[model samples]
Structure formats: structure tokens, C-alpha cells
Target: MSLTVRILIGLALGLASGIALAEWGAAWEADAVAIAQPVGKAWLGGLQMPLIPLIFALLVTGITQAAATARGNRIAGRAIALFAMLLLAAASAAALAGPLL
Candidate 1:
């Protein structure tokens, strides 16, 4: 079978097992807590581990590239101007909605 089929089967099996455990109050239920909670925490930690360096690398690369290209400042300025316009539009919409409610 293909990988997609295998993944779907695994998800179905997992859902079935979870429902069975919930019904039976089995060891699998307890194991789910023990396994899932720490694994989830560790997975989140793993994700966070690379975030700072990745963000810094991306930012530095972007800035360096922008500096090298003359249009970087203009692009950044336009982005800021567009963001300010959107913020003002959002605020105005909210203000108009508040009085109607």
C-alpha cells in the first residue's frame, strides 16, 4: 500500500484505540497520558529549539539582501504604509460596528 494509505490506516487505528480505551478504562488510557503529554511537550520544545536561530538567519539574510538591493528600503516603507492603512481601516470598521450594536 502507499504511504498515504498507511497513514490513514494508522490514524483510523489510533482513533479506534482511543475510543476503546476511553470506554474500557484500560492501561492504554493511562499510557496515553504518560506518553502523549511528555511527547507533546518534547515536540513543542524541539520546535522552539530552532525557532530563534531560524528567525535570526531569515531576518539577517533578508536584511542583507535588501541592503544589497537598493529597493529594500522602499519595499519596507511601502509595507509599513500599507500596514498603517489597514490598521486605520480596521479601527474605523470596529468603531462603526460598535455604535450599531
Candidate 2:
């Protein structure tokens, strides 16, 4: 079988196992403290293992490109301002609708 098929099968098996465990009692149920805690910690550790090098590489490449551009500062400033304005607008809308819900 293909790699995609194998990955899908693994995902399906994982989902089925999770559902079965959830249906059992607390002792059998895969709660955060029981099953997920260690798994989550290990997964996070694996993800963070190469994060520093990846971040440094990305930052160096970004800075080099930005320095090479004539209008990079202006573009970055406008992007930041637009993002802030959109974020504020979203927060204001959510606040206004919170009471109605």
C-alpha cells in the first residue's frame, strides 16, 4: 500500500482506540493526567528539539531579504498596522456580541 493509505489507517486506528478508551471508566479512560500528559510532553519536546535552529535560520533569511529590499520597512510597518486594526475590530465585535449570546 501507499504511504498515504498507511497513514490514514494509523489515524483511523488511533481514533477508534481513543473512542474505546473514552467509553470505559476513569481508570481505563485516557485522561490528560493518565495517558495524554506524557505523550503530549514527549510530542512537544520532539517539536521543540529543532525549533531554535529552524527559527534562527528563518530569522537570518528574513533579515537578509529585508535588508536587501528598499521598501521592506514600509511594507512591514503597514502589515503590522493592518493586522493590529483587524485584531482590534475582531475583539470589539466579539465583545459586543458576547452579551447577546
Candidate 3:
């Protein structure tokens, strides 16, 4: 089978098994947790390993592009300023609301 089909089947089986365990395998909960915890951590660590460098690279690229554009024209500078203001406002809102959440 193709990789896409294999991935889909794996996802379906995982969801099904989790639901089954939740509904009818209460006694196995601790065992499942014991087995899954390390696997979950490893999975997340693997996923995150490449993302830090990728995000930093993208951020650097975006900043350089934005700076170049901003230097070239008044309209671009204003647009970049507006974008920065909006970004700051959104971040501030999230920070203010995060504690309540």
C-alpha cells in the first residue's frame, strides 16, 4: 500500500483503539499510560527537532525581506508599520487573556 493509505490506516486504528480503551479497558489504563508516555514524548521531540531551526530561518528571511521592502517605498513602510502594530496588539491581547484562560 502507499504511504498515505498506511498513514491513514494507522491514524484510524489509533483513534479506534484509544476510544475502545477509554470505553471498556479501564483496568489497562495505567499500563497504557506507562507504555504511551515515553512514546508520546519521543514522538513530540522528533517533531519539534527540525521546527526550531526552520522557524528561525523563516523569521530571518521574513525580516530581511520586510526591511528591504520598507526601505524602497513610503507605502511599504506604512504597511509594515501597520502590520507590526497589529501583531503587537494581537500579542498583547493574547498575553492579557492567557492568564484568565
For 11-52, candidate 2 gives per-residue lDDT tens digits of 999999778767774664545567778898789779966755
The predictions' CA RMSDs to the true structure, in order, are 9.6, 8.4, 5.5
Alpha-carbon TM-score of each model against the true structure: 0.57, 0.49, 0.54
Better of 1 and 2 by TM-score: 1
Best by TM-score: 1
Tens-digit lDDT track of model 1 for 1-101:
99999999999999998788788897567766997898898898798666555655565566557756876777755655665566567667866996699
Model 2: lDDT equals 0.69
lDDT of 3 by residue, 1-101 (tens): 99999999999999998898888879769987999899998898799667545654565567668778766556555655665676567667876996698
Q: Candidate 3: how large is its RMSD?
A: 5.5
Model 1 alpha-carbon drift over 4 Å, by segment: 71-101
- Backbone clash count, each prediction separately: 0, 0, 0
TM-score of 2: 0.49
Better candidate number, 2 or 3, judged by lDDT = 3
